[model samples]
Target: MTRRIEQGVERGSRITIFVDGAPVAAFAGETLATALIASGRIAFRRDGRAALRGLFCNMGTCSECFVQTAVPGRAPRRLRACLTPVADGMAIETGAGPDG
Candidate 1:
């Protein structure tokens, strides 16, 4: 099931992004956190105790939505998925990050 409400919201152009080497469909203008949650992902990262973490604030304040992302020419780095927009061909790795 998808978390996105398709009733009133107009969908953007379809784009594909890789999450943990798996393909996930998303809209062009949506945030990585949006796409990930819409794709039925529950855990964004693992805490020090191996507990799962997911989107909390949905904003940039809490760092619960952290993930590692890498583009064509960019090195993999930890980023707040809620603040980063999804891009075509963007690769994401969940259950990871500096905190995990």
Candidate 2:
């Protein structure tokens, strides 16, 4: 099971988001990477070589956590999962690039 920090810090309100068409529980003010990690989902994407990639820098410097996201009436765009905040009704698709 994935474990989160338990230093008694209060988290924001809980919300639901979709990852690869699956519902995931997340809290407001939490980054997409954090929410995915908390939900035991570490593999955010796969490279062209078929290598699974996930959070690395935890910041926006690295592109390891890139994921394709789509919102209602909007075209899909690629963004770093670690830098994007988790929002209600957000839909994310992982491993969207060319398959190996």
- List clash counts for every candidate, in order: 0, 0
Give me the candidate number with maximum lDDT: 1
- What is the alpha-carbon lDDT for the whole of candidate 1? 0.86
* Whole-model Cα lDDT of every candidate shown, in order: 0.86, 0.84
The C-alpha TM-scores of every prediction are 0.84, 0.85
What digit string (tens of lDDT, one per residue) describes model 1 on residues 1-100? 6677868888789999998888999999999998988887868987789788999998899998899875668887889999999999889889554443
Clashes of 2: 0
TM-score of 1: 0.84
Which pairs of residues have clashing backbones in candidate 2? Answer: none
Cα displacement (Å) at residue 7, model 2:
5.1
